[model samples]
Target: MANAYVLVINSGSSSLKFAVIDSQSGDAVLSGLGECFGMSNPTMNWKYAGTKYDVSITGGGDHHKLAIKRLVEIINEYGLAEQVTAVGHRIVHGGEKFTKTIRINEEILAEIIKLSDLAPLHNPAGAKGIEAAIEAFPTLPQFAVFDTAFHQTMPSKAFTCTISNELYKEHGIRRYGFHGTSHYFVSREAAKVIDKPIEESSFISVHLGNGASVCAIKDGQSVDTSMGFTPLAGLMMGTRCGDIDPGIIEFLMKKGWTQEQIFSELNKNSGFLGVSGLTSDARGILEAMEEGHKGATLAFQVFTYRVAKYIASYMVTLDSLDAIIFTGGIGENALPIRREILKYLKIFGYKENEAANADARFGARGIITEDGTPVAMVIPTNEEFVIAQQSAALL
Candidate 1:
């Protein structure tokens, strides 16, 4: 089983990320990204044996077949292709239908097609990747891990919207939180970090990156999450507006804004970029703030405040806060932001070990809080490992 490798794939609208993991240790044997499909300059950038290489793909089209074909070549070149026993995919939305990871079959793929209405942007891409993987590795078993599966345990009160029950029952309109794989991996790891059994631990897992969400986990199940029906309805993000008044959309439409125009701005131009009139990145925000740019300063404030506020709000959902699991790019590395957010949670009596927080970064993992009651940690998320691990379980 140690030689059984799982090839994990995360398919997007125009790109796919692949990683080969040693299911035994969850260590990546190879990882790479294929991007710009259906374009003239389609390319694949990959890392292997501590070296990076960039090369143009053979074909350019909307289909991922050519891109994945190239990845197969890379795998074979390294002489590890034969050991690859299965494939895993990171599916963004599974809706109310799928509650856990499952091996993909023809029927399962068709059901994923039906649920495309819920994740119109992601599920189709995942399906395409699945189809491509089948074409590339005809004999390999395939597994799909849904980002919303772990949150399936959320109670109706947490997932239901204020809209009429008729709409929810008819249209399936309700909250289905995302980032379940990361939330699951980190929450359990967090329990171990603090030396508590996962089944007895309560946590608020904050996955902060370009797309951010907070999940309240009580005794190993998600009870509530900040992200609602879509990823757009949570804390401020790199490019998304997160939560906003429904009236704003109506107001903008009344002000001669097209639906496309309004949504594009909300989903693309807003967040840190909209507020700061600068790049939507933490490093950029920090740099400009140090340079006395008021816009960046304001953006920083809004980002930290909203995240802290959400963390505080999730406390009400859990029985008792065991530790706040911080993961993702910004969550793990953004020291100042993490520190400021911890300051906001001071009311909970979590002693922020300033020295420890600064030390735990750039793939470093540990409890950032001092030895005490309520703990906060910086556990770098490994969604791929979780994908590979879950896929291995099915074997």
Candidate 2:
């Protein structure tokens, strides 16, 4: 019999990323994306094994169904449909109920839907994908690999709030970290980079991108992370305001703005976009800085300073730092940003190796640190692959 394949689906507010891999070997046989989900002219691109294919929708509304339908058609066309044994979903929030990848049934689906308020931008989309996939493959088992699973190891002291226990228990409010799949996979990669066993390695992973977070991983486990309660608390992101004062919202509300208006501004209008007052794109910030834009320069400085400070704090969490790894978009490719952040934390023995940081082509894994300090490396995160591996193991 042909080896079973697992289809990994990651649904975002605006896109759907899918990967199909051999369940026994965890090797991706196909990877693709569906973009502009709710917009006109939605597009689906797929690469199966080695060949590539594309499809377009002239009028787009709900992309979850269309994307899955297109992906299934591609699989069938390649004669790989029957080989798909399982479907793995990259769910953003599993809350406290699911600590690991679990089989998705009606009960599991209901639980995930219950947590929609916690991940408003992600959970509904993920649920849609899950529902669509289950409908397409009625006989196949489905798995939910939560992004919050890896951080479940964080101790109470680190994840708990100073708020009353009654409020916490009553509202289910706590630090349920995201990007766990990325952090989990990258922490393992960092261990390999340092030639040390995962159980002994201590490191901080900075996942800087459109949505950024820093995770302190010790002994291959998450000790603490920057994101708290929501993705809106962390490093400055493309559009989301991270680590802003709570009073700001209160003040804005008192000035006549509603809760939804304040939320829309903070989660969609702020961050690099608000700070720069130009654009949210990191590359655009760099270009503006080069052109002597004061806002961009100040925004970049603030962004890097907060990142450096968090790295220092996370180092304390680890107690003995072995490496400071960078993953995600800006973390992996923005050499200048990485170098600047390292320079700001020079007091913490963090130094940049200009030559190493300048080598942008090393997308897999490589060091960017001076001698004697904890290793600083860029390990490109493959969260979908991690979900696929976890799902394969469960089956």
- Cα lDDT of all candidates, in order? 0.91, 0.87
Local accuracy of candidate 2 as per-residue lDDT tens digits, 240-307: 98988788988998899999999999988898899999999999999999999999998899899999
| Runs off by more than 4 Å, candidate 2 | 1-4, 22-27, 49-52, 58-62, 360-362
Kindly list the per-residue Cα lDDT of model 1 for residues 1-395, writing each as its tens digit.
Answer: 43889999999988999999988888888999988877778788988889999988874355488888888888999998889999999999898888988999999999998889988889999999999999899999999999999999999999999999999999899999999999999998888887889899899999999899999999989999988888899999999999999999999999999999998999899999999999899889989999999999999999999999999988888768888989999999999899889888888887789889989999999888888557888999999999999998998
Residue 258, candidate 1: alpha-carbon lDDT: 100
Pairs that collide, model 2: none
Quantify how close model 2 is to the true structure by its C-alpha RMSD in Å: 1.9
Q: List ranges where model 1 is wrong by over 4 Å.
A: none
Q: Tell me the lDDT of model 2 at 255.
A: 100
